[model samples]
Target chain A: MNDFKIIDDVMPDVPPPVVGAVAEARARVFRPHRPHRLRLRFPVWAGGVVAAAATVAVIGTAVAVPLLGDGAGDRTGDGATATATALVDSPGAEEVLDAVADRLARREEPERANWRVETELIERWPFAGDEFLVENRDREVHWAGPDGPAVVEVSRVGTEPLTAADRAAWEQAGSPRLCGSDSDCENDQVPYGRTRYIPADPGDYHLSSVRLSPQELRELPQDPVELKEEILSRWARALKDIENSDTPPGGDVPSDGDAVWWVGQRLLTEAPTTPQTRAAVLRMLSTLPDVRITDGVRDIEGRAGLALTRDTGGPYAERIVVDRATGDPLAVEGMPTVPVPQLKGLPTGSAAFSKLIRRMGWTDEAPALPEGCTPRTKKDCLR
Target chain B: MITAPDEVSSITAPERFGVVFDTHYEEIRRYIGRRLDLDIAEDLAAETFLIAFRRRDRFDPARGSVRPWLYGIATNLVGRHRRAELRRYRALAKTGPPPDDDGHDQRVVDRVAAGVTVGRLSGALARLPRGERDAVLLAAYGGLTYDEIAEALGVAYGTVASRLSRARARLRDWLGVEL
Candidate 1:
C-alpha cells in the first residue's frame, strides 16, 4: 500500500564502482589546470617567427621587380593586399542590406491613419509514409488603425490534396470524410476558403505580435547598436517571464545573440517600420556575422532577389528573400534542416512552412470586403 | 567572535565545490540513475558536477542548502533524456519488476505483491504528462519536499502540489488504491 516505497524499490540500483569510475573520469577531464606561461609562450613565439620568415620571403621575392612601378612583385603585393582587405570589408549581404536601408530611408513616408498588412502562410507536413500533406495555406490581413481598434481578416486559400501515398493510406483507414451529409463533402474536403473578419484586441499590438503601434515604432532606436541591445534585453525579459511561469523540459532559453537575430528578423517582417527603423534594422542585421548573402534567389512569384539566410540553430532554418531592386522582402521561407520527429515521416530540407507577403504597408483607405460578397451571407468572399 | 552552530559559514570556491560534491554526489547520482539507465546516469552525474563546478560562483548559500541545487541540476539533466525516461517507464509497465533472486520468504512475498502495484504505477507514470510525472517522481523517489521540488523543477510551490496531486489522483484511479 506504500506507493512511495514501491516507486523507490523499482528504481535500478547503482553500485559504488560505477560512481567511482564516473567521478574519476570527471576529475580527469574537467579538473582545473594551472596556467603554464611557458607552454603558451612557446607556440606564440614559434607562430610569430614562422609568420615573419614567410613575410620576409614574400617581400624579398617581390623586390625582384619585372617593371618599374607596376612590377610583378607590386601586382602580387596589391593582389594580396586586396584579398586581405576583402576579408575585412562588408560582405555582399551587408552591402545589399545597406542599399535597401538607404532606399527605404530616402523614400517618402506615406500619411495614413491605418496600415493594412496582408500575408499568406503555407504549412506542409508529411503524414503516413511518403505522403506530404499541405495542412493549411491561410491568407491573413491585419489592419492597425492609428488610434482605433485593429482588425484581422483570415481566409484559407485552399488545402492541398494528400500525396499519392498519403491518399492510399487515408483510403485504407476507412477513407474517412467526417461530414453530416454527402452535400458537405466538397466543403469538408477543402474546409477553408471563406474570409472572416475579426476585431483584434488592442493588447495584441505589441512587439511580440510583430505589430507595433505608430508611437512604439517611432520610439525604436535609430542607432543599430542601441537597437540590437534593446531587442536583446526585451527578448531576454520576455523569456525570463516565460521561464518563471513554466520551464519547458529540455527547452533552452535562447542566448542573447540568437535573441538579437530573431528580433532583427521579426522587425524586418512583422513590425511597422519607419525609414529610420528600417535602416537601423538593416544595419543591425549587417553587423551579424552569421547572415550569409546568396545571389539569384527567386520567390514563389518568380521574381529574382538576393537572399539573406541565417541558420537559426535548430531543426528549422529560415531565409528571407529581398527584391534586388527595391529591397522589399519578397518571401520568407523556413525549412527543416533535420527530420522533425513530431511530423512523423517528414524528411530534412523540406519547405514544410513558408510565408509570402502578398502586400504590406500603410494605407488611408479602409479595408473593403471581397467582390460579390453580401453583408448577411458572406459566401465566395475570398479572391 | 564565535559563530552560532546552526548558522551557515562561507568557504573558498574550491573547498566549497569539493564539500558539495562529497556531500551530495551519491544522492545526485541515485536521482539520475532512477530516471535513466545506470550507465548514462554515471556520465550525467559527472556532468552535473562539472556544470556545478563551473557555476559555483552563482550558487548562493543564503537561499538554500547545496542539496536542492545539486538535485535541481540532476533533474535538469534528467529532463534532457525525457524520451529515454518515458521509454523506461513503458518498458517497466510491459515487463513487471525484475525477477527476484532471493529465496521465498515473508519479505519476498510482500515484495512480489508490491511488484504488481509497481507495474501498474509504471504504466500510469508513463501515461502522465511529463511535467506532472517529473513532479511525482521527484517527490516520491527523489525524496524532495514540496518547496524543494518546486525549487528543483523551477516551478511555483502551488504548481508542484497541483502537479503531484493530479498525478497521484490519476494513479489512484488507475490502480484503485487509496493512496
Candidate 2:
C-alpha cells in the first residue's frame, strides 16, 4: 500500500508536455486517449520535447500511464459503453433474434433428459516458456444430449511408451498415468476413464470440468507440420464449444503444448438491449468490466507479441498475436488467471521449458491453422 | 473549496486533477519517502497521482476522500515492482533513519515519529506472511474495506478478513497499538 499524506506536496506536478513521450507510447497501446494527443489517434510523435524541471517533476517515467486514471470525468454515464452498444436494439434486435430462434425452432425435436458434451482429442504437443512449461493438451467437447454423463479416454503416444521409470513416477503421482501396474490407477477404462458431473444450472456456467491426466501429457514433436496440425485442430474445436457455453469456462487447448490460456469472459445470454446493459456499461466505464487484455506485452522468440486470452463464450477467445509484419504467431498466452490456494493445485512455480504460459509476440505470418479449418463459431469472441 | 470526487463537474473534473496533484504532490511525496527510498518513492508517488487522475472516473461520490483509493492504487503499483520494495526495506534496515528534510529539531521529531514508527507497526507488518502483509497494509495505509481490498488484490473477502485479523493480531503485539 502507499503512504499518500506528504508525498503529494513535496512533489511538483508532471506537466502534460513532459509526460508526452511515454504518454505517446501509452496512447499507441491503449489508443484514442482523450483531451491530449488528439492527433488522429495514435501518432508516434517524432522526437521528444524537454520541459523545464520546475514545470514537470523529475520523477521521470517508465512507459507508465500515471496509475489507472479515474472515471470521474466520464460523461458517458448516461449511455451504454461501446461494447454494450452492439447489443442495443438498433432495430435489428427482433430480426436477429427471430432468425436465430427460427434456426433452433427448426430442430423440432423433443428435448432430451440427459445433456452430455463430449471432449474428443484434436491434437497436442510440447509447449515451452520462460520459467513454466507444459505440453499443449486438450480434450474435445462431446455434444451428446442426455447420455448419462461426460466421458473421455486417455492413452500415451510417446515413442518410448511409459518407461519403467515413468510408471514409477506415475505411482507416486497417485497414478493418473495409464497402463501403470498400480492397482489404484483411474486410467483403466475407455470412453469413460472419468465421468465428472457439471450441473446444467446457470450457476455452474463458468465451470470447466476435465480429468487432468499425466497419461495425456506427451513431449512435443520436432516436426512443425505435425505439431501445428495437432495443436490447431484442437484449438479450433475448443474455440467453438466455449462460445456455446453459458459460463465462459476455459481449459487446455484440445491439444498439447506449453501454453497458458488466459481466458477472460463476459457472460451474457441476453445482449445489452435491456436496461441492465446500460447500468452495466456505466459500471464498466467507472471500473473496467470483466474483459481484460492478456499478459500484456512480452518478448516471444525474440520478437514483440501478445499471447491469447480467451473468454470461452463463443468460438472461444482463443487467438494468437500474428506479427503485423510477418503475420505469424510469435507466441501464445491466455488468462482468467485464478490464483489457487497454496498446496491446493500443482506446485506453484514456473519452469521455462516446462512452464507454458501464453503471450502475444511478433510474427512474420498468420499462425498456421489445421487443414480445412473453419473459424471458431463467431459468438462474440471478445466476451 | 474542494468538493468530493463525485461533485466535480465532469468538464472541470479532468482539470481539477491537475490542481489536486499540484497541491498535494509534496505531502504524497514525503509520505512515500518515509515508506520507501527517496528516489524510488518519488517515482511511485508521482505515478500514484497520475494514476489517481486516470482513475478519477471510479471515485465514488459516496466515498468522499480520494486518499484511500489513491493509496490502494499506489499499493498495487508498488506491488508490481515488489523486488524494488524488498530492496528498499533491506536498504532501509541498514540506512538507519530516513533523511529528514526540515533539519530543524530533526532529532526530536524524528525520534518521536520513529517511536510511533509503525516500526513496531512496520516490524509486525514485516513479520506478517506475504498474504497477510498485503491485507494489513491495504487496510492500514490504504483504508480499503474488506471488499475493496479483496477486489483490488483479486482475492476473496474472507481471505481479506483472515489476513487482516492475523496481521492486526501481530501488529497489536508489536506496536502495542490498542485495536
Docking class of 2: incorrect
Q: Best candidate, lDDT-wise?
A: 1
- Each candidate structure's TM-score, on Cα atoms with residue i matched to residue i, is 0.45, 0.31
Q: lDDT for every model? A: 0.51, 0.31
lDDT at A64, model 1: 10
Every model's DockQ, to 2 decimals?
0.08, 0.06
Candidate 1, chain A: TM-score against the reference = 0.60
Cα-based lDDT at residue A168, candidate 2? 49
What 10-residue stretch in candidate 1 chain A is worst by lDDT? A43-52
Chain B TM-score in each of the candidates: 0.83, 0.62
Q: What are the runs in model 1 whose C-alpha is more than 4 Å off?
A: A1-91, A127-130, A162-191, A209-213, A236-251, A338-350, A368-383, B1-179
| TM-score of chain A by itself in each prediction | 0.60, 0.21
lDDT of 2 by residue, A1-383 (tens): 33222112221222222345334322221212334312221111110000000011112432222112211111221222323322221344323333332343233323333222222211111111001111222222212122221211122222111235433443554443222111112111111232221111111111011111211211222222332333334434544543453322211121112111211111011111112221222222212222233223342223443222322221112223223232223333221122221111222221111112222111222222223322222111110
Q: Kindly state the number of residue pairs that clash in model 1.
A: 0
Model 1 Cα lDDT, one tens digit per residue, A15-111: 5554355344323222212233212111101000001011111112111100000001111101111011111122475466567778876877775
